[model samples]
Target: MAFFNREDIDNFDKIHRINLMNSLSGYKSANLLGSISPEGQENVAVFSSVVHLGSTPPVLGFILRPTTVPRNTYENLKETGFYTINHITQTIAEDAHHTSAKYDKGISEFEMTSLTPEYKNGFLAPFVQESPVQIGMKYLEEYYIKANDTIMVVGEIQFFYVKDEMLQEDGFLNLSKGRVATINGLDGYAIPNLFTRYEYQRPKKIENSI
Candidate 1:
């Protein structure tokens, strides 16, 4: 077994420390956040931090690293108040990951990579056409994380488009059916399978024993 303490992690090389820390949380959702600037310049970037905040209003959130550097997705979404979250799948994993490359502000990642952008129902932002699960999001609010200087941007799901076969009757999404990809670390991409589904659990009644 390997062990790493706070001091040990701090002493490691920059890349080593970053890779180790980013992977400690295990597999994360792989998504492509699509946004368009006010001037209609589209931006698509890969992210692993998108998370469900609530079901009542279908809220979701994703973290943005400290804005010391250029963050086109963050800038576009903030200005336009709209974005799209699209699930990355096995078929487009490579192209999706390529979006992580830092490009000039006006350059469209869609043109650089094999990924294609689709506009649905007159939504302001574009969605990845190859993604199985596509969600149109309206910006809600954001919280500043004092500890790490990151920002958590929250949004409400305005539109959801999922493949017919992937949605279960009870409202569960079977990601395996779509070959959805998950992030193992900063760069590793994997396609997970459906193991087994368990029903809601309740405490078992205890009986008197002789």
Candidate 2:
């Protein structure tokens, strides 16, 4: 087995260290965050950090790299207070990954890739037409992580659109049925299969030894 301590990881090559650190958390949710500038310029970028922050408020959060460089998605969402989170699917994995490429301001990733921008009910931000699960979000708050200089952006789910068949009766989203993609590392995309899902657990009485 391979072992890496703090010092060893710190001394690794830049690319190697980044890859190891990013993938160490295992498979992450692959999502495309869609936003529109006040001037109506649309931007979409692939992200693997989207996470459910709370159920009561239907809040979700995602991590963003430092703002030292230009981040169109972040800028747009901050200014407009709206964005879309779309689940990446197996069919659009390549195009979804391509959105990660840095582009100049005002350039729409939807135009550069095969993906299509979808607008519904006059929502300012667009959603990926090919995604099986699409969520409209309203910017809520953000926290700065001093340790890594990253930012955690939080939002409240305003609208949710999922394929009917993918939603189970108990309100569980069976992502495997929709063929949603997950990120392994920086560039690896995979479609996970469904393993058995256990029911909610409860503490059981211990059996005394005979």
Candidate 3:
């Protein structure tokens, strides 16, 4: 057996190692923000900064850049108090990536891409019709992480639409099998190949407790 050392044959430093890992942790779920225009032109901008805050209250969160940047998503979420969360997949990956472009104000990324934006369930927020899963959410509280100049906009889910076949036998979240994509790093997306399905714990007794 051979042991490897990180310091010996390094092409990148420790910082690079950490940055790369954090950037490529996994492909992130891409979401599109929809809001009524100040001048009545509805718009959509794709974002991959979404996070799952909790499961009990079904909290979902997304991060946005500062107000000074004139980000439409930031404006819409603040103005409308609602948005749609769409899961990413291999099929929509290219279009999902295209949404990241810094488009002109009032320009609709939905029209530019192949994604179809549809309104359902009586909410003003729009969602991608082709996604395997889509969730409609209502605005919630926001908190500042402090260390980073970022704000977490948490939302409570009204209802989530999911494909029935994506459910696991034990009712676990089976995103990998759904071929749902994720953002690994800052600008890349990939589909994960799942090889493990069981939850593991440290001690043998932990298994019993679980």
Task: Identify the candidate with maximal lDDT.
Answer: 1
**Whole-model lDDT values for every prediction:** 0.96, 0.95, 0.75
Ranking by lDDT: 1, 2, 3
Every model's TM-score: 0.97, 0.97, 0.79
* lDDT tens digits, residue span 106-195, model 3: 688887899888888887877888888888888888888777678888989889888887877776767776788877665667778878
Kindly provide the TM-score of model 1 when superposed on the true structure, using C-alpha atoms.
0.97
What are the per-model C-alpha RMSD values against the true structure? 1.1, 1.1, 5.3
Better of 1 and 3 by lDDT: 1
Provide backbone clash counts, one per model. Answer: 0, 0, 9
The global Cα lDDT (0 to 1) of model 2 is: 0.95
Quality of model 3 by C-alpha lDDT: 0.75
lDDT of candidate model 1 versus the reference: 0.96
Give the per-residue lDDT of model 2 (tens digit) for 31-114: 999999999899999999999999898999999999999999999999999999999999999999999998898689999999
**Candidate 1 lDDT by residue in tens digits, 1-210:** 998799998899999989988999999999999999999999999999999999998899999999999999999999999999999999999999999999999799999998999998999999999999999999999999999999999999998899999999999999999999999989999999999999999999999899
